[model samples]
Target: MDWLTFAAFALFAVFSGLGAAFLLRRFGGSSGQWLDALDRLERRIREDLVANREEASKAARGLREEVVGTLKDMAVLQKSTLDGFGAQMGRLTNSLEQRLDAFARQIGDLTKANEMRQEALRATVELRLGQLQEDNAAKLEQMRQTVDEKLQGTLEKRLGESFKLVSERLEQVQKGLGEMQSLANGVGDLKKVLTNVKTRGTWGEVQLGNLLEQILTPDQFMANVACREGSSDRVEYVIRLPGRGEGDGEVWLPIDAKFPREDYERLVEAAERADPEAVEASARALEARIKQSAKDIAGKYVHPPRTTDFAILFLPTEGLYAEVLRRPGLMDALQRDYRVNLCGPTTLGALLNSLQMGFRTLAIQQRSSEVWEILGAVKSEFGKYGEVLDKVQKKLVEASNSIEDISVRRRAIDRKLRGVAALPNDGAKAVLELIEPADVEPD
Candidate 1:
């Protein structure tokens, strides 16, 4: 029994023994039998109590030992868990630090890109403005020369008539000036459009889309594609690479167009003003921007096995594309670090053409495989036809041999008839008797 049950039994025994002893002593005082019975009961109760005590002690000792072992195991488990947790924390800390460093580097590159774009835009604006000024100056000089020539001619001819004509010419000059002002306003509006970052991006996307439409079919490329699983962010375009062999799925090749026009403008402005320090600064900035763009493209779009290992960064304008190429180690760095490919309009067109050719070649190979299978089937059918022809030829030969045997039998019968005829009347009579006729009486 359990400890509680054993204790209950022992308590009852003790109470019963005490009650019986008390009654026996009260009812049978001085009786030897009653005293003996009470003594026996007491002895029995004492023996049971001693046995119960020993069992309880043993059980208690066992329970204590079990609890001590459990505590030791728990302590060991706790230590192991703590060690694992500490190692995990260390790994997490290192990963966090590396991520932070990479993020900081990316931020620095973005800042440089912004600086470069501003410089390039400034330079472009200055150049356009200078050209416009030169054109205006030339027109003014031409007008001045025309006026001087008209004045000289008018002085030698009718002075009043010349002055009236000069006033009309002045009105025409004013009209021309108004037109020039309108042109200048248009240029200002264009500059404003280009200055805005969103407008520039929109323009670049449009240009990229137009080029793609011209070069490839609609099925060949998809626009505004979400490249990653469980992501809402979209890339501008992705080319669909046709799969080779049966059951192989199509692969994606992502293309992102980036126009860092603002930095480019800043660089142009600095160069125009002959500021060596600013130009160098802009150059460095442009380099950083290109690098950052490549890195971003690689991170966002280039997923190996799903997409190509490398992604393309398209620069719409040739000048920007050329500028990126001119940077020392820039292209190599982009390819090595980011798995990014930089392509301008012309180069991208060529690449698309090559891809198209590859697709055509794959199609041809598939078709060839199908044709070979058909040829194999045809060969199998031809073999069956040859077997049928052999069977038919064997039947024809058996029929010919039967016809020859029948002809030989007919000739032997004819010879026997001839022999009977040549034996004279005696032989003919014997033959006739052998083929006896029916009796006349029966008819």
Candidate 2:
């Protein structure tokens, strides 16, 4: 039994013994019968206590047995459950293994099929590549043969054309050589002509005359002019300038050509020889010759009021002019001392053109008053013209008014004759003849 049941049984036995002892003590002075009854009661109580103890022990043993049986039943149930769960797990594992094997087999089959397809595709590509290469080779060989044949023909044609062109070029070269020989002979003749002093002077004069003729009108300039009074020193050309005053006569601008060919040739030769001393000597000689020529022109041609204060000395060749210009301060010296201006062909052309412009300006200045008078006359005539136009406009207005009056009279006539009916052509003409002649006359 449990501790509580066992303690209750022990307590019952102790109380029974104490109660018997108490009765014996309290009834000691009375009789022995009271003590005997107490004894019997204690014996009965002890018997009951022993009996209760046996029942509690039996109940405890029964309870322990029930608990052990329940535990055994639970252990059996758990074992069965574990067995069922293990079996289910084994079946599931077997099913998964079967499915995985099938899946692996499918994967292997797909891999074989893929490999077979790749091999077939590779074989087909190889066949196609071989066929294509064979076709390309044949085409390339055919193209090469065609190109070779065309190239051969083209080369032959080009070669023939080249030969023909070469022959034509050879003929042109021969012709050019002939022209060059003639040119050389002409150059020799020109050199001979230039060697003479008179011929050189004539050449310079001809060049100067050509430049003047080209730039100036014939009437604008004079040939071989004696610029000074009672002087026989005639200049080659002279351009006439307008006089400064109305009473003053025309001024002359003298241009004379000079060529010191010998000195110029010597300078050219010394430069070509690369001899500094010879070049200096030749240059000085040429400069002296030019200065002497300028002095001669200044003395002979320059006459103030008759001619310009300065005269032009013309150099025919630009090379000679350039050499003269190269002489340091020579142009300034000539202009300051001799009153002579140096001119090449180009410079003389420019000078003549400037003079021509000056002449035109002078002509325009002389005619400006006349032009103004003409404009004044036109202005006066324009006023009279305006008056005449006003009269014509008035006449036109009167005529227009008369035409309107005639239109009204014609309409009235037509209204009166409308009731008379139409007439034949002869009758109409007879009627017109019978009408007043003044009515038919033109206004």
Best by TM-score: 2
Q: What is the lDDT of residue 234 in candidate 1?
A: 81
Q: Candidate 2, residues 111-203: lDDT per residue as tens digits?
A: 999999999999999999999999999999999999998898899899989999999898889888888888898898788779888888888
Candidate 1 lDDT score relative to the true structure: 0.85
Clashing residue pairs in candidate 2 (N, C-alpha, C atoms within 3 angstroms): none
lDDT of 1 at 227: 84
CA deviation > 4 Å runs, candidate 2: 1-188, 273-277, 407-443
Taking the tens digit of each residue's C-alpha lDDT, what string does model 1 give over 92-162? 99999999999999999998998899899899999999999999999999999999899888776777677
Which regions of candidate 1 fall more than 4 Å away from where they truly are? 1-189, 370-443
TM-score of each: 0.43, 0.52
Error of 2 at 113 (Å): 64
Clashes of each: 22, 0
TM-score of 2: 0.52
Q: Residue 382 deviation, candidate 2, in Å?
A: 2.1
